[model samples]
Target: MLIEVRNIFFSYLPRTPFQVRALEGVSLTITQGESIGIVGRTGCGKSTLVQHFNGLLIPEEGQVLVEGVDTRVKGEALKAIRRKVGLVFQYPEDQFFEENVFQEIAFAPKNMGVEGKELEERVRWAMEMVGLDFATLRDKSPFELSGGQMRRVAIASILSMQPEVLVLDEPTAGLDPQGKRLILGKLRKLREEHALTLVIVSHSMEDLAQIVDRIVIMDRGKIAFDGPIRVAFSQGDFVKQFGIFPPVVSQVASLLRSRGFEINPGVLTPAELAEEIRVKILEKKEREHAGSKRGNWSVRPS
Candidate 1:
């Protein structure tokens, strides 16, 4: 397993009136090279959970293991663990401190002790990976870019560290459709090319449906559902009860079924739903043709 959580429990405060249990005995295992999506309503501890994967938060009552090593074992090892699990927080632009895009992205590798030719190479590669033009944008101030570009620079900063597992918290929270698509496309390519394990904490059902192989729905600091994307979406009642919407395609299919359509329940994408509708129309036409032939035969019968 690339990551493992065993009987984990965490609280904001300990033994106080303000104490709130953020996580209650949540356990999960993520293998290497797998893409997992975490979805939940606001304040459901989704962000709290991914923070533990990189040692940002120590388990108050359980264990968090990365690559079979327990995170609680305090030492110089934690730094290496942090490098292995790169976290891009919500509104990552707010975390940028450098004056120029190049310095902002180079910060991580520099901190990791990469220098000289190695540092320049890592920064250039990271910028290119996130689709930033090195020669044109490197000297420009990070704050001068648009929101989408700033977000990409923030991501590139982490990529400079070259983490094995990339954990993104609401990566597309505030962006135009084109920006969202650009970031998602880059992430998909990175996962395929680098075999990077992606852990996305998002509320966007459409984005999750399109990218994630497995979906884990969290409710009230507990695992509500953990399975393949299709299986998780099939639990409509459970999902509705939690106030989370199924993928748009799933909802469309459900509505069509209610209206007496023979569409399959497994449709989870617009492309799949469109294809299903086309096939159904063809089938209906074929049935009408057969009916017309039968009526003509009856009229000719003596």
Candidate 2:
């Protein structure tokens, strides 16, 4: 396992009356090159759980092991562990402080002691990964860029570290459809080309279905379900209880199944649902032809 969360239990504001149990005996594992989605309603501890992957938060009871190194260990061990996991918070663009785009993207790698031509190459590589041209956007002010470009800059800053695992919280939040598609599409290709592990916390079921292979559902400070994307979306009744919507196609399939139509609830994409409908229609037409040929039809009066 690249990372493992072994029966973790965590609470905020410990020992105070305001203490809130954020994680409750939660356990999970992530393999290298895996793309997983962490989803739940608001205040469901999704963000709190992902923070532990990079050693930002340690479990109060159990342990979070990243590449066999416990995040609870401090000093160089912890720093090394964090270097492998890059976290991009929600509204990450808001964290930008550099005056120029190149400086912004190079900030993290610079802090890690990379310098000179090597640092410049890292910045250029990261910008290119996010589809930003180094020459054109390098000297421009990050704050002057469009919202989508600004978000890309923030993401590149993390990528400059060349982390093995990339964790993003609400990555596409508050973006227009075009902006959302741009970021997600770039990330999809980046993960494949770099063989990087990706974990995203998202509220958009449709978006998650397009990019993630596994779905982890959290509820009430605990993991409710962790399975293949289709399996998680297949449980309409269960997910609905937690106010988590499955993919639109899954929802449509379930509605059809409930109406006595022959539909497999495991459908996750529009193409799958469309193919199922086509097959059913063909079967219906064939049955109707056979029935018509059986005997002379008698008209029934209503």
Stretches of candidate 1 exceeding 4 Å from the true structure = 287-302
Q: What is the lDDT of candidate 2?
A: 0.91
Query: Candidate 1 on 202-249: residue-level lDDT in tens?
Result: 989889887788988899999888888877775677788766788878
Q: How accurate is candidate 1 locally (lDDT)?
A: 0.90
Clashes of 1: 0
lDDT to native, each model: 0.90, 0.91
> Which runs of model 2 end up more than 4 angstroms from their true locations?
283-302
Candidate 2, 1-302: lDDT as tens digits = 99999999999999999999999999999999999999988999999999999989988999999999899888889888888999999999888888999899888889899999999999999999989999999999999998999889999999999999999999999999999999999999888788889999999998888889999999989988899988888888888888888877998999999999889878887988999999999998888788767765632244
RMSD of each: 2.7, 2.5
**Residue 272 of candidate 1: its Cα lDDT?**
91
